[model samples]
Every structure is written in C-alpha cells, then in structure tokens.
Target: MPQTIAEKILQNHTREEVRPGRIVRCRVDMVLANDITAPLAIKSFRAMGAERVFDRDRVALVCDHFTPNKDIDSAEQVKTVRQFAEAMGVTHYYEGGNVGVEHALLPEQGIVGPGDVVVGADSHTCTYGGLGAFATGMGSTDIAAAMALGETWFKVPPSIRVELYGTPQPHVSAKDYMLRLIGEIGVAGALYKALEFGGPAVEALSVEGRMTMANMAIEAGGKVGLFAVDDKTVAYARRAGRSGNQVMAPDAGAEYERVVDIHVDDMSPQVACPHLPDNVRAVDEVAGLRIDQAVIGSCTNGRIEDMRVAAAVLKGRRVADRVRCIVLPATPSIWKQALKEGLIEIFMDAGCVVGPATCGPCLGGHMGILAGGERAIATTNRNFKGRMGSLESEVYLSNPAVAAASAVVGEIVHPSHL
Candidate 1:
C-alpha cells in the first residue's frame, strides 16, 4: 500500500490517503500564469465575480513568453495580466527586465518547494518536480479556479519509475538523458502518469540538470516528472534562499505501473529531430547536417551550466558566417550572473546575439525566427515543425554543447569536433 512520491505529495495537500486514479481536492501552494495564459485566466476569474484571489501572495504572474512585447497585440495581452496582478495586489508579479520563463523563475525565486502542490498555466510547470514538488499544468479556466479557491481536484496519476543506473559521460548531460527517455518511451509513452526519476544516476544530476529533465516530461506525455528530495534538492533549495529540509521520497515498496532503467554511461549527445521529441538520434547520426540558426536557451537547458558549456565550446570560435546564433538566459537573474561571469561577452564575441531573458524565439515568439526552408539546431525543448517560426522551417533539439558546436560550423556537430 506504499505510495509513490507524486502520490504522497498530492495526498499531503489533500490531507488524505490517496492513490492513483482517485479524485481528490488539494490545496495549492502556488498558482502561476504567464502573459499568454493569464489573460484567459483573468477573464475566468472575473467571470466568477471573484474580486480577490484565494491567497494573493500565492499567485504569481510572469510576463515571459511574449514579453518585451513582440507587438501591440502582445503588449496589450501582457498589460491585461499586469493590470490583473496590480488590482489583485499579487506580490509575485514579474514583468519587463524582471520577467522570466515561469518554469525557470518559479524555482529560482523559491516560490516552489518540496512537498508543495504548484499549478501553473504552463506545461513545463512540472519543472518544479525537480525540487520534489507535486506540480502540473492546467488550462486557464482550471488555473482561474485555483486562483479563486486556492485548490483544485485531480485524478492522481499512476507512476512510472525511471531508474538511472550509471553516471553520465562527460558532455553527455541530462538533456541527452531525457532525449533518450523520450525516444524509448515515444511522445505519448507516459500519458497521464507520474514519471519518477530515481536511482544512482538521477541522484548525481545537478539541480539544473534535474530541472531540464523535469521540464521536458510533458514532451513524453507525462502528467508530472519527479525526483526524490535528496541532498542535491536540499542544497538547491537552500541556495535559492529557501529551507530545503522538506525531504520526501517514495516508500521502499511503492508500486509503479512500469519501471524503465537507463545506463547513462552508454549514452551520447542526442537530438530530437524536426517534428517530434521522440524522434531522437545520437550526435554522430546527424553530424554534418546543415543548419541556418542555433539557439542556446529555453526553460530546458538554459541554466548557468548550459551557458558555461556553450561558452566553453565557443570561447575563441566564430559562428559560421552563414549561421545566426542566439543565446538567451532563462531568467533575468541568470542573465545578470552570466554577465558577471563574462559568458555573455564570450557569446557576443563569437558572433552570437545575446538576447534578453525572455522565452523569445523558443515558441516562435520572436528574436530568432527562421525563414522558409531554414533549419535550426537549438538547445531549447521541443522541435515540432514551425515551433520556432514558419511551418517550412525545421528545428533540431540538442544540448548546449552540440548547439554551440553547430553554431560554429553551421551544421549539426558534436563538441568534440571543436
């Protein structure tokens, strides 16, 4: 009768013994929305005639996706969220200069934590699971309901246990590990199921690496991706200025619908080619494939570690003359840190455009949009057709090392080539 970590967290919030498939109403520790989702949520909140949020301090609004406002329409959309945050007296609202991708910012700000239930209007809200939180995404209306009630109902999902058996090889990072999982599981492999990453290898991943793993869980159709709260989680939470003692893990006898074990040492740099996250292949498989653009940022693979790797690969190298390389920090704080560390200067010196800490170009919002028939190699998550621009364009997803190396050569290549 033991429960998984996801079940335990959800049960704690509901104050009840819960199991997969059981419907339960749980209190939410955090509720988040971005420029794109907040407007619809605000309308729903107003439609409910709710003048006050269940807990103003618990609700956060971030203007990341389309901020720095791509156009008047985007500006007005963000303005709506801004006004709503103001009227509601929400203290966590962030915009302009301070804005960051919600998934990345929430954890960095200490707004999400272990054993908490966080709901955001972003699929990658699951990213908080890296800290052992029970977090997930929902439609704007559902988010609005959470805003009004500070709680929502959920059908607890069954769990899938992913055990990492060995340490990753150098330069073979969590991004590569995740792509391998997606390739094995297919895009819909874990549909509506909790993906619990555990075992020695996962325990060895840095918080940034764990974040990259959890952030892409949705790409495999997972309801949530969770890592047990270990010393690494505590260290990360403490570093983010939060008490990190909220340790939680699945019981020894916890049941899982399925278990998949991966030997990380056997893996290499991987990329999800155009059209699907599960369409993964090794770096050598696609090496020498031409590309017109290369981007190194997103909620996935945009941490300082990612930046450092890209900078290491591009230190004295120039981006290929025909290629455009763009670097975006996931959060303003990370941006400033990169600046202090001179990673920004290194990128600019290598002929890359150091962009604002927005979700720019990740979702085709702006900054590095590709033209027809163009192809890009990016460290960002997702590579579906038209994900970063025209439908005729293609996106190949990889880790920052591959992204940086490709930027230099104007072709998909591995860091070893540099």
Candidate 2:
C-alpha cells in the first residue's frame, strides 16, 4: 500500500502494517517534557513504580517555560524536574544556562532527526516534523508511560497534502503562509490529521522557515506537520552532528484525506487578530492600529533568521516612545549568535529590551505582561484571550519583520511602510 511520510515513519518504528485510524505501538526515538509539564509527568512516573526511564539517552527534560524562577511556584516546579533528571541520569537534561525551549533545543542538539518518533508533553513538539520526523504532543501521563516503556500507542492519522506553488514576496514569510492557511481552514479544519507540506516552494524554504510553519500546524488542529527529507534536511542534521538516516517520503500514489494548494507570489504579510489564530488578515487591512508592546520571539519565530530580520528593520530606528518592544532569542545559543552578529546592539540602540532565552511572556508567564486594555503585536504563535496577560489586553500575531516594523511605528503596519 502507498504510504505518506507519517505512515512510513510509523510503520518503520513498529515494523507493522500501519494505516490511518489503526492503533499501533511504536518505539519512541525521543521523549521530552518541560518544567511546566515534567513535574506532573514525574509524579505519574513515580506512581507507575518506574525507577528508571527505558533509555536515559532518549529522554529530555527542558526547563524553559518559567525558568529564571518567575516565582516560588515555578521554582518548585523546576526543582521537581531537576531532581527527577538527576535521579534518572537522563543524558539530555537542560536547565539554567543550558536550557533552550524544548522544541527548538531538541533539533539543535541532534536529539531528534529524520524518521524519528518523538512525543513531548507540549503541543509544539510537532515542530520536529520539519526535520522529516513523526512527532506529536501528548498528555503528561502519556509521556510518563512513554518514558518508562520507550514505546507509545498512536492512532495513525490521515494526511492533508498542502501544495505550495510560488515564492513569497519580500517581508512575507512562512508565518504569513501558516496564518493564511489557518484562516482558510479554520482552527479545526485539519483536526487529528497530519499536514504534509510539499511543492516547489517547500524546497525553496529554509529549514528555519519550515520549522516555523510546522510549529504552527497545531494551531490548525493538525496532529503533525511533515516535510519530506531532502538535501536541506540532510545538511541541517549534519550541522547538528547527526547523520540523517531512515529518511523517508510519501509514495507516488500516497493517499490523502484532502489536498489544498496555496500560491504565495502576491501574498502579503499576514497577522492573526485577538482571540483566535484563524482570525487572520493582511497587514495592510489593519495598519495604524496602535500597539502598546511589540514582542519578537518565542519558539515560533525566535531563530537566528528571525533575529536578523528584526535587526534589519530596527537597524537605526528607535521604538516608539510609548511602545515597549521586547526581543527574546528562544535559546542561549541563538542569543549568543545574535550578540555576535551585532543584532543585540541594534536592538539595544533601538530601545528594545533583549531578554534571556525562555518561553517567557508568550504564555503570560512573565517579563512583558500586558496591562488591561493594552495591545501588543508579537511574533509568538497564538493570540488567545489572556494568553500574554490581562484578558482585556489584545495580541496581534505576526512575523518578526512585521513585529519590528510595528514597534518602530507603534502601530500595526507592513514592513514596507517603515
């Protein structure tokens, strides 16, 4: 039977005939949990009477959510995860200076690669599908079981083929494409389905861009977002010191639940308005909407490419006097790279605050919380009510370029307007 990339990966892991809707137990290549979720998973692990993880090297514990100890509660949370890691001798434990956002850190460290099966306690774990992996997020309890057994059950999901045919225009990015897609399909459009991204544009997109797109697939209710392994995938794995193996792609006659084609030649930078990711509009449609804050980082857009784009826009311009612009680098390494590239200097000169690597403020954790009635434009993924602060405050989601441009103008605007 013809199979898609997700199906192929699942079949390879289980050595079984896998098909959509079939429940199969597959070996997990990597299992991850973060400070926010790891504590609960650890509790469950203890309840299971599992003293050690199935494979210490395959388990990762990241402390990125509320790290730097936002408060006593968060501090205690990290303490629990840290103790668990030490007790288990987990090889991929990360915290303090070594911590990076779990989704970004795993790929950067070569802890996950092509055709791997990865399950994490956070939804954005789907980000690894950009590397041609079968990755998904599960509940903390499910993660606990996976850690103890090195295997998990999955009901194989049908696939959605998203074919991209044209190059994006200047200042437009994969974020825009993803927002546009979510807008077209609505949040529940691809529920429990794998998103197979391909076509000419997929090959043109950078690995970082693909990662950004895959990161947001969950917003569209996708089970996972996958791209076929190619030269770029191999090179990315090589840079991370992994020999990309088990590389797979869909068969020529692979079946899909549905097919959607998106052409981006004339597409504009897109933004998601308050309350829902599917509430997207072209930037021009909402230009001049004053913003109180501008954030340019998160797991979604916190890569080096995003930092360079923001720096290019903020090079000599200062942020608006009343608008606070905050930039986070997602991981310590990305932060250091930005500093070496002088992007940090540019941001500081522009009056933007450069924060440490954390998921801070994205989930209303801390650092740049919004006050009631305030508005923010951010490169972060979601814009749900109270996501970054007061329920009365609003968030507009955009790519880093648009967020930086908005910061300079203190209003939502296209990068070209700057």
For each candidate in the order shown, give its overall lDDT on alpha carbons. Answer: 0.90, 0.93
Q: Per-residue lDDT for 172-228 in model 1, tens only?
A: 899999999999999999998999999888888898899899999999999899999
lDDT of 2 by residue, 134-168 (tens): 89999999999999999999999999999988988
lDDT of 2 at 136: 94
Lowest summed lDDT window (length 10), candidate 2: 240-249
Q: Which residue runs does candidate 1 get wrong by more than 4 Å?
A: none
TM for every model, in the order presented, reads 0.98, 0.99
In model 1, pairs of residues that clash are: none
- Report how far residue 277 has shifted in candidate 2, in Å: 0.3
In angstroms, how far off is 125's CA in candidate 2? 0.2
